[model samples]
Target: MMCNSASGSAAGFLLFTDVDGCLVNKNDYGFAPAVPVLRRLRTEGIPVVLASSKTGCELQHLAEQFELEPAPLICENGGEILWRESDGGNTRTVAGAERSKILRALNGLKPTFQFRSFADLELHGVMAATNLSEAEAIRALDRHSTEPLIWDDAPDRIPVFAEYLQEFGLTLTRGGRFWHVAGNASKGSAMDIVIQHYRSRLTTPVTTIAVGDSPIDQDMLDRADIPIAIPDPEGRFHVQVSSNGHRAGEAGSLGWAETMTRILDDVTGCD
Candidate 1:
């Protein structure tokens, strides 16, 4: 928990965060108590980038909820970047083709297996299955699916799957639900692109901080000057910042907000 020394110095700091496992709760309703800390950072002119596996449509909605004024967004597990225009107009998506290709591949593989997109499967709808464990689904997916598949869970699973793919000279990324199998495109790479976009506007180097809860976030976390992970009940990822073992705390987006607050406190010396 090392806080930044230059807190309140008026320097521009970029905070890159994941949406699903970091900011919003798993249910996608309200943010954790720590969310105000992030809001404080924003008020101080610190830039917070929402790097997530959420779609552009979802991210757009989230940006509104956070009152972010079109901050940089990383979607589809970091395969895409969305940004607001300088004139504060509509948000623009930058990774359409890659996302389409991955979706096309996943759809192509669906006939032989049980695969569905988050958009296609509502959490409490007819398609929702309480009987099926995610692990079982992942095992089935790994055994039968030829195309790369991703089941959302531990952050370590992405690297593990990446390593598994490397054995076959292939690679896969874990997005919200649909696994992405294609050329090299990841959250880390997307974050890099976003950083470059900010770099072009400034003379001083920007300090990058990324927060996430799963293996898919590892690359972005590795790239960040500071990386934080919220607690997971299963203890799958083992991040430095463990929540007070709230077995069923806010899971997805709300968890992200909780972690962001911790990071913001460190970055802004709010403690």
Candidate 2:
């Protein structure tokens, strides 16, 4: 069954967001400041689709927490897109190479690169490395299409390593905590997929607004009709993507709320 546009009209607005530094603060994992704005968006019939480097399992919980169920999720740095099926089951659309193949290629290069992959880090090890609770670590470890790893080799060798990965139809992306290896699919491509999915169902034009605060989010930002960047904890816009020549005034969820509020106001004339 098809869902109608969130706007309850011919036209709609969609929001794509990053998780760690945009909606939830890295230090406290709190999104209280964004709660009001999130409510407002929902009230205004905007679908808040979350696009993140997190796993599907992790995003599932977040989508629930934020009451965004039924919205498509872009997971593992755009390696996969997941959504709830009509029967309450889940459907996944993958865009990148399989995780096993990515791991196989990485293992072949183990002789030259010294890195520790998430698959090798078990639960407790991931907890120690990421400071996440056991449950969070488990959710984070659930991978479908990407492999995140810590590079133990010299920094200068990263470019060479990336080149090597490219030979196997893979690419490396830097994240907040680890470097990720996956197929060439990016957040920009994944967002396009989600947008197209909605467009096929909706009668009116959809306006996309993407928000994030990291280099990994550059692709998503590049794809948005309105790209909003949140400042880092230090109040500096850290994402390398173009924010449509604008930057949020604050950091974390506060900045997220402020920027979205301001942008939505400009876009829809909502107070």
Candidate 3:
């Protein structure tokens, strides 16, 4: 909508992106291909918020690498929000039950379901499952409000498992890597809150560009003024992303760079 309106005249733009399969290539976990586009967006003064199912510790560390110091973060699939205040103080907003409670509920369902959660996998197992380094694995295991697990049960039973989770005030969603169980909070709601945080400080309307590569990011893409969908490495996409404003030319980091370069160029007339 902003692109159709007056892109150059918009007050500001907020870029909310999922980490895996969107910014970072899922295979290699590298984002070098997108670094140039990210740098361009940074130079244009756009704030890029990393929204992912990753733990706060993981997201915080990745944010530093992406140079998103003051940008807000939506972590654990929007179970938490972290940002820096104007006075250089850090603030955190948490949603849903804590990890312990979620794990307790999950433990109760273990007899009925066949799954291995991050808690069960521990550090070494998590590293093997995610192909992350020792330090990154440690960060991934430090979750706050969500439990990511590999579901070994029948695929048809996912709906029933979701129903069972509902009774415990939890829900299930699929991410690029694993299934995530979390509270009622979602990326869309978190985006709204962060947008409000921006609107309250700025005099002009802030345009939002949301990008992702899986069903986990559907809610976020639905809420964005401009939604960009990046396909998986095999060039496949989820069916729920019918409303996306732009579909990338490639998959993973290459696609991320491709679509974002176009959008930024179109919106800001920036080279």
In model 2, what lDDT does residue 80 have?
A: 96
**Compared with the true structure, what per-residue lDDT tens digits does model 1 show for residues 1-271?**
5454453543667888776545755433446554676667667677778876555556666677787745677766655566866576655545424434545555654554454453344333212432224532332222111233435455554565456445543456553334655446678888888889889986667888777776677788778776776555344554443342222234555555565565556456765
Clashing pairs in model 3, backbone N/Cα/C closer than 3 A? none
Residues 1-271, candidate 2: write the lDDT tens digits. Answer: 2333345531478889998888888777899989988887877778888888899999988888987647889999999998866466898999988999998998899999899999888898888888899999999988989998998999999999999999999999887668999998888899999999999998888888888888888888887878888888878776755536357888788888888877766655444
Q: In what order do the candidates fall by TM-score, top score first?
A: 3, 2, 1
Candidate 2, after superposition: displacement of residue 205 in Å? 0.9
Off by over 4 Å in 1: 1-10, 91-100, 107-114, 117-171, 175-178, 181-183, 238-266, 269-271
Listed in order, each prediction's TM-score against the native is 0.67, 0.91, 0.93
TM-score of 2: 0.91
Pairs in steric clash, model 2: none
Clashes of 2: 0
C-alpha lDDT (0 to 100) for residue 214 of candidate 3: 83
What ranges in model 3 sit over 4 Å off?
1-10, 85-88, 239-244
lDDT of 3 at 230: 90
Q: Which 10 consecutive positions of candidate 2 have the poorest summed lDDT?
A: 1-10
